[model samples]
Every structure is written in C-alpha cells, then in structure tokens.
Target: MNNMSVELNYGYNGAIQPYNKQFKSNFSGFNHFEVGIRYMFSEHLGAKIIYKSDKFVNDPGGNIGIQYNSLGAGVVYNIGKKIGLTYLTRDNLGLLFHLEGSVGFANSLIQQYESEKTKIIGIGITPQYRINNKIAITTDFTYNINLKQLYGFDGFPINTTKISETGSFYNLSIGLIYYIGENKYHSDWY
Candidate 1:
C-alpha cells in the first residue's frame, strides 16, 4: 500500500535578527510557504521531508525582498486513535493532533555583501481535521533555532574576529494534506 501524503503550507515567519552590529540588520513582516512529502509507517508514526521559503524586507516599503530557503526532515507522532478519539464535528469528520521535531539547514542572503547559512532545529505541534478519508486540513505552530559560527579574521596587525551564536524564529502555518493510500496506516504483515 502507498502510505504517502503531500502538503502545502502557508503562514507567517518571524524576522531574522542578527546577533552583532557588525552583521546585517533585522527585518520583520516575513511570510512563509512550504511543501512536503510524508510517509506513514503506522497509524501513529510517520516521517516528513519539507522545503520552505521565506520572504522578508529590509525596511518598510523596501523595493526588493530577500528569500530564505530551508530544507528539513521531521518525525511525526499521531495522537488521534491512541487516545480513543475519533470524529469531532460530524460524521466522517475526524480531529487529530501530532507532535514533530526536525533538523535541517537554512540558506539565507544577508544583502549583497555576504551569505549566511545556519543549521536549524525545530519543534512543532499540528492539529488537523480530516474532511474525508483522502483529505485533511491542518495547522501547525513551529519554533526554530538557527545555529551558525563566524571565524576570526585571516591576518592583520593583531586583529581577529570571532563569531558563534544561535538565532530563533517561529512559524504558524495552515495547509491541506492529501493522502495517497487506501488506508491511513499499513498492516504489520505488509
């Protein structure tokens, strides 16, 4: 059986703030979009790989916006059937909850001067309502940490630069999930 799904997510992404003044500045009002593929191994366990794009501006009414791209893999823990819960609003309508953790890389542009790349770690909670056996609506809230290190300057009189820090961001997403299997989960014997 094909226990797979594809999803598209859209939501708000927090601004990227630099740790030091020597680095680039901060910007707000960012937007996010993501696409992913999920493989469900069981009724309560799944894995997902996703790619996300974030749009941000330098200042208010800025002409051009920077695009940040991130790719990650996460584990999903399903909690609907485990708690003996099923439909919520109507017949064939089911409510489900999931917890997820992920790790990946984020590539960002810090103006035309230099590029910034960071390792990202995130945790999220998703609540979904199944519209039918093949489709569902889901919303997720994820918190992400960006980790990077800056090296010291190469050579000078007595000059050196040292940089190593972690930044953070949060995302709230709403999306549709489409299933590609006859059942939500596969049998152990299969």
Candidate 2:
C-alpha cells in the first residue's frame, strides 16, 4: 500500500504577542501558505514534512512588517479505530493531532538583517472529511513559538535572551487534500 498523501493549503497568519501597539502593527490578511507531505509508516503512527511561509504587515500608517519562512519535520499521531494497531486504516472522516519542533532561518527587511537561524515548536490539530475515495476537505489550527531572540526595526531587540523570550503566532486554515493509492476506508463506510 502506498501510504503517502500530499496537501496544499493557504490561510491567515498573525502574531499573538509583541504587537507593538505603538505602531499598530499586525499581519497581512491571508498571507500564509503551506505544503506538506505525510507518510503513514504504521496504522496509528507516521511522520510528515512541512514548509510554510508567513508574511506580517502593519495597519494603515504603520511601518513595521516581518516575514518568516520555516521547514519542519514531525511525528503524526492518527486518531480512529485500530488505534493500537501498527497498520493504519483509512477512515472517511477522522481527526489527527500533530506536534512538531523545527529550526529555520529568518530575514527582516525592517532591520536589514540577513538570514538568521531560529528554532520553533508547533502544535496543531487537523480534522478531515473525505469527499470521495481520493479527495477530502481539511481544516487545521496551529500555534507556533519562536525559540530565538526576535528583533524589530532599526535592529532593536524585541525578544532578548533567546529561548527565554516569547515570540509566537497562530494560524487557522482550510484546504483540500488528495490521497494517492487509497480509498475511503473509514469504519462508517463499511
């Protein structure tokens, strides 16, 4: 069985902290996109690779924005019947929980900074509804934490002391998914 699936998604991304009220900064609406490939090694366990791009912007009259690019690999935990089995069974509709840790590089146009490596940890949940044997609609809610120090305009430090500081964001997305070499195998369909 080919236990592989690929997904393409687009959504809104924004920062949850350090909003810089003074500048009234925020994020560009619908400014994030992601591509992920998931391989189910076992029935209830697997791994996935993801790449995401996020762009932040300020409100009208504000002059601060940042862009984040990240690549992550993480463990995938499937939730459904055959939960304890090593071989995964496809369900027409199912839920998945994922936790991932990643290290990526960032660049800031406001501060004239080059590529700087940063660490991040993310946790998210995905709910999928199959449309047929190979197509489905999926929604994901994810939160990410930046583990390295963050800087703002003029090269000023925003979050100092690296891991000690708090720099985080959240994403809410909905997209379509296509499964390869698989059929709707949910218990409900049988």
Candidate 3:
C-alpha cells in the first residue's frame, strides 16, 4: 500500500498568561490552524512536515497580539497498527510578540506606548492513538527557545527585553483525526 497521508488541525489555545503574573504581560486567546503531510516508510516508520499559524488579542489596555508561523518536520513510529509516536524539529518561520500597557497622565503630560516584534525557533513531539481505520486521537507538546520577551511600555526598549531562557516555553494540544482514503482489498488476505 502507498502509505501517504495529509492532515489538517483546527484548535484553540486556552490559559493565556505569563509564567509570572507579576510580569504584566500575557498572550491573547486565539484559534490555531495547521496543515501537514506524512509519508510512511513502513508501518513502523514515517516522516512528516507541517505548517501552523495563530492569531489573538492581548491585555492591560492596548490590543495584545501574537503571531506564530512555523515549519516542522518529524519522524513517526507506529506501535502495531493502532498507535503511533512522533518526534519533530520545528523552526519558527515568523513570530511577533506585542504588549501595551495602560496610558496615564502625570502633571498634565500624557504618555502612550506599545511593544512589538519578536521571533524564535523551537521543537516538539506528538503521540497519537488510532481508534479505528478512520478516526484517531492525538496530542502534542512543544517547546521554544531564545525567544524575545514581550515589549513593555516603560521598562524595555524594542528587542531589548530578556531573551527567553532555553527550554522555557511549551504547549499541549489534544484533538481528533479523520482519514480520507479508499480501503484496499486483498484476495489472498481474505
């Protein structure tokens, strides 16, 4: 059989907050979209490439937004025909992190400001369970490194915030897969 597959993912990101609430920066809640293609070398081995995009609004006053465009390539290993595990290496194609704080008046002076523009590369892993021929459940965990911190209105200059400590950020997702293909029939197997 020609074991090639294409998958698409649609999901949402919840729990949008900074690791430390004292930082006064947080991500906006948003929907995510991903598309990928996989080629199976055998029932036990395969490789895939994927692209993803995310958009959202931020907090504290001015609109906060984050955009992630990434390309990931990975290998998959199946446990029998019912379950599989995958490891991926992802590169952040483009990333933007923005934060804006509340404006104020001091002695008849008004201040306004916003922070923007940050990018990085990352890696991830995914584990999936197939319930049957056409349906499966999947989850993923991802971590990014050397990312620029969110811009602050009065604290840091553009691209001057503390760089993300390596191995500092990660994401988890759970979702379903629907396969579309014609089932093959073999006379000898029957």
Q: Of the candidates shown, which would achieve the greatest lDDT relative to the real structure?
A: 2
Winner on TM-score (1 vs 2): 2
- Best-to-worst ranking by TM-score: 2, 1, 3
Clashes of 1: 0
All candidates: TM-score: 0.72, 0.80, 0.52
Clashing pairs in 2: 43-86, 43-87, 43-88, 91-186
**Candidate 2 segments exceeding 4 Å error:** 61-63, 82-90, 152-156, 159-164, 182-190
Which prediction has more favorable lDDT, 2 or 3? 2
- lDDT of model 1 at position 98: 39
Q: For residue 19, what is the lDDT in candidate 3?
A: 35
RMSD of each: 6.2, 4.4, 11.6
Per-residue lDDT for 24 in model 2? 46
Q: What tens digits encode model 3's per-residue C-alpha lDDT throughout 33-102?
A: 6676766666556676766654433455424344445565665555333321122211111111111111
Cand. 3 Cα-lDDT = 0.42
The digit string of per-residue lDDT tens for model 1 on 1-190 reads 5568898889977654442334243444547888988887876677888888766544555433345577778787665545544423332333334334344333223333334455677778776766766777888888776565231110011123545555566778899888776754321112
The lDDT per prediction is 0.58, 0.69, 0.42
Worst 10 residues of 2 by lDDT: 81-90
Compose the digit string of candidate 2's lDDT tens values, residues 1-190. Answer: 4567887888988677655557645554677788888888765677889998877677664345766788999887777434522134344566777898877566665655555667889999887777876677889888988876465321235655533355788888888776666554422122
Query: Model 3, residue 20: displacement in angstroms?
Result: 9.6
